[model samples]
Target: MTGRTGLEAVRIQHVLPYDPRQPGGVQTHTYALSRALSDVGHDSTIFAPSRPLRVSLGGTRADLALHPLDALALRRFLRLPHDLLHIQEPLLPAVGPLALLHPSPVPTVVTLHSAEVVAHRFYRWTAPLTRRLMRRADALICASPISHQTAVPAISYEPRIIYPCLDLAAFSAVTRNPEPNTILFVGRDEPRKGLTLLLRAIRQLPQAKLVIAGPVRHSTRQLADGRTTFLGPIPHEEIPLLMKSATCAAFPASGGEALGLVLIESMAAGVPLVASDIPGYRIATNNGDAALLSPPNDPDALAQNLLRLLDDAQLRERLANRGREAANRFDSHVIARQHLDLYQSLVPA
Candidate 1:
């Protein structure tokens, strides 16, 4: 049955390497894309291990850790009836490798979401196998140009660029009630996420009140003083409100970002942004036109950018307006239509 797009509805199975319940970009992308597809009358089902096994790398969770049993189960499930399969992070162990290597009857599309593919130990260790499995995909997509550049050398193929989708309406609906001199930061407690760097930056801005969302380590929690508030791991639905409450948002990721979805979310919420000037972030903010950018790992630069946004209301207004315009490009419905077109191209009429 055809829906609004005038194309037959397709059954799409999305395979995620990590637990969907976990708050992460891949999870959010899958959920948003699936919902958007469903809105246009497509059938979308998400599959992942009920409980993912965790591995720590440099004191942070390694998302690519192998789950052999889970991979085997996912491999078996791939045989089930489906019009198409959309696999995220196809090099990620166990779901990714097993799913990609599985001889499914349906067309498979794999999306590369990591910018640090060349540097990741797991990707390096399984390079040969990854190269082989990648060839089996019917189509390939990269979240951003940085991801494309990092993946092409390893996989030997250029993938079409497709930015991650977000629920722009929900974020746009948030009532803007910015608190004076308030800065909001949302990320997991990882070194790559640069929470420590943001903290150091906050030290330089004495009048800034920082609001942090997402999980935090005890040692890191100890660092928060009267000026900082930790609202650990809030529900995804509440992010819009949290974003709207701030005068501006900061994403100080040091490295290893494929696409900074938070940057897009901040833009959608019509909040001014101060983010690290990295490849992935640069793409998300349209070469830093939508936000103020600073050098990664430089606390002074980040602090200075944050202070500038706080002090200049006119600059904040201009960035927020530009951000909302940039964010419209990632609206879920628009991305869903692109996926629908890709699915149609793969499926026989």
Candidate 2:
């Protein structure tokens, strides 16, 4: 009950480190939630780390763009708020949020979105520290059930599941008509995302074209067959159009994802998906039969799956129909309402 009047009385503040130019999944997720909440007559500000040159967009008036924090900066910064503070994290590499959580007046909720935490390889030492941070939260929201299950066993807290969302309507509307021979991939081009495998798969895929619309961290030279077009780091907004235009959106993650947001996005666009057979995709798609799920890290299998979808029409329609239905649960409006309900439940009546 601060900042604005009337329906805006129950204001909430969410702190995110969003850079418009290099926005990641967390930035997209947080901004979409804030926008959706605003549509439903709730007021919230996304306190992002300062933009490189202070770029302003239309929806920014309702959100705050804060500078990146030092030790002193965070101490002073966390002091101000609308109601509760929602921290979006992959978790800090060195120090956890204990410094902020210990004396903070605002009730905090954190949406955990890290594969490393579950994999237990990177920063294994911080397992205890991460759990401690979870205990301090007034509430916790996870991007997927896999993340929830991973974090739940390691920590004392049990977070609620709120899958990373997509603009379902936008995706659905965009994919009414499609292009032939165009394929899409929307993830970091690391070995983990199986870009290598995808590239290998593409070698066997004759005449079809693939556009890798993400960063290529490793040697792209090896994967550089004549048929592949590597358009590095396309904007998030532009991805839907790309997916819609494509014959199918591709994801072949080797390790795993908490949720396959891109898969659902492709599904929303009515693009058939060729993804890995992981628990995360299984959960996100609800086994919707929209995607061609195959074994992890297998280029041959990946290629075959993609080929199958491309060759067949009835299979594609089956996937498109089922994916459209399954993707409804992740609309920004519905997701924001779920978080709002959780917030209301957590706050004292």
Candidate 3:
């Protein structure tokens, strides 16, 4: 694939187990990276299920709709024409085993983005098969150090660390003045995400209003009073504006977060952060330098941190400015080149 000065333009296919129509970090990352590659003269396509709700993360939609794993679907995926096969979530039994059963005709790359706890539980039954498939990949990537640690024991080769990248310029160009006392919370209402704790914290700070931007699943706690408003699944394109309008972005995940993509968006938008002190959040925010760290599952600590950011103007500005500068390292162009270089390395020298 190497040319005189750089690698020649080639087609790449990304296989995803879930639908991109739903709002998710992995889907958003895959779509954004595909757009970045297109800007650099490379063609990228996604193979995922076609849900009724069609959505695009500011890029081309999935080229082909993948079906449930079976002999038919497996054969269909194997016949696609491409220079490389990129698997987003590598441990899914439905699609991952195909890479091992019949090795792809071209190079294959796998990216692992889950925490150790979740990955272990999901792959416990088919550990050996998953390990073998991971080993067979030409390149392995983990989005964070915690992800790398979680995936190392499954494969023989060391995985490269690549943080999830975003279009920082888009978020930076947004010039909307933030609304005071408006705290934005994104992501689904999972137990690990600490939405319950956030509600309790909000109760302590009666003056602040919390704007929830995602779907809530099985959250019986009703806090939709005058203090909370649920926007109900904001589009991927509008996330930058939502971030820019918030006084502070909160991701109070108690556990099981590999890399908080919302934290990156908050930083890129120059919005101060209030995240839980979990390993994934620590690695994502550089050990609390970029965000205000609160104890996991503690409403009092979360409330205190939120109040601190809301109370002090200098502290918010300082953290926001630092986060903006730190976000440049995870820009879309920088990460696209990294993947391009890795793809070129897999070919013969």
Candidate 4:
């Protein structure tokens, strides 16, 4: 199990059921984990949908050929020399059950990234299936306390809490922007993500501008006041500079995040945060020590918090410095070592 250099270099196979063209926290987390494993002298390969990707967000890419549950695919995966099969966001109906049945021979670890799958209107029918899958996992990894709470009732075993890892070195390389007054928001425009609420809050502040990164699904009336700028689908490498240049970062997601990677990235860049007081964010920030909390779904509270951070330079600096320190806990090397330890525990002594 140990390499010649006295290090554990186990091979890991990460299974992702989601599309690569649509980038989100889960995609970012998978890619970061792969890179982190490599840094630790371990090998990681991703099994994702077989599609022509429009954009390349480079990690170790391999194809699952959209048949993750097929008998041939299952056998193929089970036969691999990989020590562990890590199923990211294992709530998908197709992939979750595969761990329970044919591939039961392999030691498997399942990471549950969101609680939404249990409550989504379309996925409600799959509740029983999801619970069974959760119980079948050899070792379960919850991305945050909220995610752990959601998985606890469904499974008989205790789930280990591992915060998603971040590439802090990349963010540290970027120089912090001087005289930053721009509030940064990164994520798709969705009801659950609170994009509308963010725009409404922007209307209340005349002295601040909000930089909306990522794709927007809903069209909005022209708020040509020059207070908000939409930069669609920003490159992943450029995100550190964007966070570094931010006066403060805002993520007002109302609910359903296992762990907010954007919040972690902002914290890593030493940028102050104004996030919704949801369980996911609350657990990540250690009960609001790392960031300011505004009540969810209330545009006025969001606006007030934004104004408070924008108007007070001393408050922003204090929160930013604390956030940077807190972000160290989620660094790539630290998280990778924790995961390697977990993988070691699952194997025979």
Candidate 5:
């Protein structure tokens, strides 16, 4: 019912800029869904950072630009008729003003992507605010069951689980030739991502090569084993190829109480996964289907799991096959439809 309306009939407001140069799961998901919502014939407006890139996404007319909520000039734009307004993230640099604009006459939906307050120190200031904003929105969305379970207890209403999506077509460039021996980790080189433990795990398997493809700051240098290669933030378009080149993906994820998009992205590229045994990973994999799970934060356990997957080709194949199926659920188009349903539920077409 959400999308079953005319263009001017349903004005869905989305807040988030589409910056291709900056690669991140939230950026990808926000832009992809905003574009899809337009394709389904629903009119929408995008409010985001004050300074937006001059370029436009491939096929969506989101009227992209910065709306800096606090700006005096943008106050009039905020009053425009909108049936639904979707806020992507609840942390600062994003939700700061969006939260203030909440309880608007129009229905609002806020997504709790990460428990950054616990993950990073800078975000500690946002934890209480995040809890407050969660109660303010008419609807809430979570990328994983674990995320919802961890984040929603503080809010007045239960947050619905609507997994973040991936546009599979974006990764069609990857050539899936079946060489399941290498391991890839596509995340920033933060301490919480468990980079040190991954290095120790790689050390356990001498033959296995590891490629960590993300921005590696000084913290990354601390864990730099001469053998590991940091490709320095590859473009999202090339992520599939990078994953395809490897036998599987590795994520010693320890930062946030949320799901890792890289794991699903790797699976979509037909690459098996080797992830931490956290609640988020367990909910994402449904228990070791798309990846080999090891005890969380334990390099030795991760090493054993890596060694086991590397040595057993048949088991690796099984995981890959199962992972492919689970990955399908996160396809952008399918997930977009689910969001449409949620919006309609709140607006009541």
Candidate 6:
């Protein structure tokens, strides 16, 4: 079979460490990338644990848990047939490391996803093992320059930087009907996610109504009032509508991000953004060009940026236009083509 580019189609096996049911960046990337590859006339299958149910996207679910038995299941799956094996977050335990360590039947490409992995003491202790596992990969790719830099110290090799892909067509199709003074925040309920800071910032904006998405912790739930609405753990298909309904989106993560996918999603939806000024977010926003940036963990600064967007409709319009333009670079088709080119290079024509 040949793809649209007139090259022989390649069969790719994507290995994700986390469960697809839990909404996160890496899981979303795997689903979007696989769908994109399929759209471009390639065979892409995802292999991951089946916690409650398998992902709706075409793939086989394994009953393997995070134990030694996972290697046995992976060994059996590897024998099924594939031209290339793409493992996400190879430094993670159990499946990711096991797959990288074990001999593979095909060329392997490993994507490093976390920027904070190197800072952990566990990574330091297992640096030698991680380095050996990484050497087995035929190609190494990082989702962002921040991830590339973080991997160099541990792996002793530079990885090619590729921005994470998004379904731009879906977001672009969404109708923009921004609610007046409406602010949206999407992420887990972790402290590093800066939901606390966003809550504090909302306190200063009396007229602003905040919408919280994803899992909200019990402690954070108590803080929600009549002004806040929590739509917890929405389906991926509903994200475009959620993004379109917002006046502006806010991502206030204090740290621990490789590249914020929400920033790209917000931009693709043509919603104005006010995100943290961190290394990961800076890469996503093109150094604060596409969105308003404020110092991380500073509620006062975050509030000021949100206020500016709320008060001035002209500024919001300008940022929304710039954001849509910036999001074009990370379109799914473009990123899928890059991956296909890499796979073609590794495999035969």
When 3 and 5 are scored with TM-score, the better candidate is 3
TM values, all candidates: 0.94, 0.85, 0.89, 0.86, 0.82, 0.93
Error in Å for residue 181 of model 2: 2.4
Which pairs of residues collide in model 6? none
- Model 2 ranges with Cα > 4 A deviation: 1-9, 17-20, 51-77, 94-99, 117-124
Candidate 5, residues 1-349, lDDT tens digits: the string is: 3344432346787765333346666777787787777777877676555544344222112232344543433355567777887877654343334444644787878776654444234334456765665566788787777666556444566678898887876554467765545777887666667877788778778788788887777765676676677788787777777866787778887646466677877776777778887877776786766788888888888888888887887887788778878877877779888987787778855
- List candidate 3 stretches off by more than 4 Å: 1-6, 51-66, 69-74
Query: Which candidate achieves the best lDDT against the true structure?
Result: 1
Choose 2 or 3, whichever is better by lDDT.
3
Error of 1 at 126 (Å): 3.5
lDDT of 2: 0.69
The 10-residue segment of model 1 with minimum total lDDT is 57-66
Q: What's the lDDT for residue 57 in model 3?
A: 20
TM-score of 2: 0.85
Backbone collision tally, model 5: 2
Question: What ranking of all candidate models by TM-score puts the best one first?
Answer: 1, 6, 3, 4, 2, 5
Taking the tens digit of each residue's C-alpha lDDT, what string does model 3 give over 189-224? 767788878988898897799999887754434655
Cα lDDT tens digits for candidate 2, 32-76: 788887777777776554433333322121122343443344455
**Residue 91 shift from truth in candidate 3, angstroms:** 1.5
Best by TM-score: 1
Clashes of 2: 1
Candidate 4, 64-139: lDDT as tens digits: 3245345356557657777778888776444445644654555789887664534343334555666666666788
Model 4 alpha-carbon drift over 4 Å, by segment = 1-5, 52-77, 117-128, 178-180, 221-224
Model 3's number of clashes is 0
The root-mean-square deviation over C-alpha atoms between each candidate and the true structure, in angstroms, is: 2.0, 5.8, 4.6, 4.6, 5.9, 4.3
- What TM-score does structure 4 among the candidates reach? 0.86
